[model samples]
Target: MSIIRSERRNRYTTISNTVFTNNQLSFQAMGMLSYILSKPDNWSVSPAQLITVTKNTAKKTARDGVYAILKELKDTGFVGIEKLSTGDTNYIVYDTPIAKKPNPYNTDMGDPNTAKPDPYKPDPSEPTLIKTDIKQELKSNNKDLLSSKHDDTNPSDKNSDSAKQVIQHLNAVTGSKFQCCKSNINHINGRLNDGYTVEDLCLVITQKQIEWGSDGKMAQYIRPSTLFKASKFSGYLQAAKITKLNPDNRPVTLADFDDLTWGKDLGL
Candidate 1:
C-alpha cells in the first residue's frame, strides 16, 4: 500500500503525446499505459494482476498482448520493471518524461506529404560558429552539473548501510537468509521515512520469528516483503507488543525443562 505521488503535469503530457504524436503504439498499448497511470503511485502489481484488472477494460483477452504492452512501456522508459525474489515481476509506472530520439522528418518547416530534405542541397542561411575552448569548457561544466544532480538524487551510503543492518538482523532472528538488494533497501528506507524506527522493525522481526519459527507451515512466510511492508509494519508492531505481554509457549525449547526429571527428582 506504499503509494508514491504522481506528477499531474508530467502524466498529462506523456499520455497526450503518446496518443497524438507517437503514432507507434497500438490501441492496446495506449490503453495499458492509461490504466497503469490511473493506478496509485508506487503500487506494485504483478503481470497477472495487471492482466486481470486491465483485460476487461482494455478489451484484450490475450496475456501475450498485455505482456507486449508492458514490454513496450519498459523499453520506451514509460515504466520500470523490478523482478522480485518470488519469481514475480513488479511494474512501476511513473509520470515522468520519456527520452526520445529527435525526428528529423518531423520538422516545423516540412509538410507531412513532402519529400525529405536533400543531403547535397545547400541552405541559404549563414552558419554561426562558436570557439572550441568555450565549447569544451561548457561541456565540462554541464557534465559536472549533471553529476552533482545525480548524487543528490541517489541514496547515501549511510542509508544503504542501515538497510543492510536491518536485513542482517532479520536473517539472524528468523534463521532465514535474505540478501540486501536495491528493492529491499528501498522498502526498508521508505518505512523508516514513515516514522518507524530500526528498533521497532527489529522488534517485529524477532517477535514474528518467535511466534512462527516452530511452525513448519508459517516459517516459509517469514520474509522481508511480508514482515517489513509499509502498510503492515504498524500492525505487526502492535501484534508484537501483545504477544510479548502474553508470551507464547511456541518458543519454548527442551533447554527450558532440563532441570526437571522423573517423579523422584520432583520431590516425590
Candidate 2:
C-alpha cells in the first residue's frame, strides 16, 4: 500500500498513536474519539448534535449510532461520560486510553466442557419421579397444541380486535403512530397464534418502552418489524417476564452515570 503523510505547521490536534493500534476499539470508535480529542478542552456536544456534524463521513449517522461510538470509546477507557447536575451529559476524552482494571472473569478457569460428568446410577425409587415429570411435560405440550387449535378456530373479527389492542398499547407506550394495518396486524396475529396472549404482547411493548423510550438511539427500534419479529419476540417476552417479577427494578428517573464502574461493564 502506498501512503502519503502531511506535515502540519499550525492548527493541528495532537493525539496518541496508541488509539490507532488499539484492537479493542472499532474504526468508528477510534475516529469519534479522535474527533472529540481534537476539540478544545470543555467542548461539549450531545450525541444528537454530533450526528449532524459527522453526516459527510457517516451517511447513516443517528443519535443511537453516535451513542454507540461514544460508548465504545468509553468502554475502552478512551472517554468518560458524566451527566451533569444541569441534566446535560459531558464527555471527557483521555489523551491516552486509561488503564483498565484487571478483570477477574478473564482468569483462566479450566474449560467447563472438559469436566467429567457424574456417573449415573439409577435410583430404584426414582421411576415414579421420572414418570411424573414426563406426564407434566406431555400435559403442557397438549395444552399448547389445544391452544393453537383454538387460535386457528377464532373468528377473524376477534383476531382483528386483539391486534388493534396490541397496537394501541404499543402506540401508547412508545409514542408511535402504528395502526392496525394488515402488516402490523399480521405481526401481532403471528405472536397470538404462537400461544401468546394480547396481554403478553402488551407486556413486551411496555417493558421495551421502559428500556428504550428515553434512549434516543434505541427509541427508533420500537417498531413492528423489530418488536414482533418471530426470532426476537420470545426473548423480548422473556425479558418482560423478568421485569414483571421485579417491578421495582425499573428506572423511574434519570440518574448520573459512573463511567469507572458502569461504562467499562456495558456490553456492545
**Model 1, total clashes:** 1
**Each model's lDDT:** 0.52, 0.59
Q: Best candidate per TM-score, number?
A: 2
Task: Work out candidate 2's RMSD over C-alphas.
Answer: 17.6
Q: How large is the C-alpha RMSD of every model relative to the true structure? A: 25.7, 17.6
Give the lDDT of residue 81 in candidate 1.
Answer: 58
In lDDT terms, how accurate is model 2? 0.59
Runs in model 2 deviating more than 4 A are 56-58, 100-268
Query: Cα deviation of 149 in candidate 1 (Å)?
Result: 26
Per-residue lDDT over 172-241 for candidate 1, one digit per residue giving the tens place of the 0 to 100 score: 3443446666666677888778887766666676567656654558867677777888778889989876
- For model 1 the local lDDT of residue 111 reads 52
lDDT of 2 at 102: 56
TM-score for predicted model 1 compared with the true structure? 0.34
Model 1 lowest lDDT segment of ten: 259-268
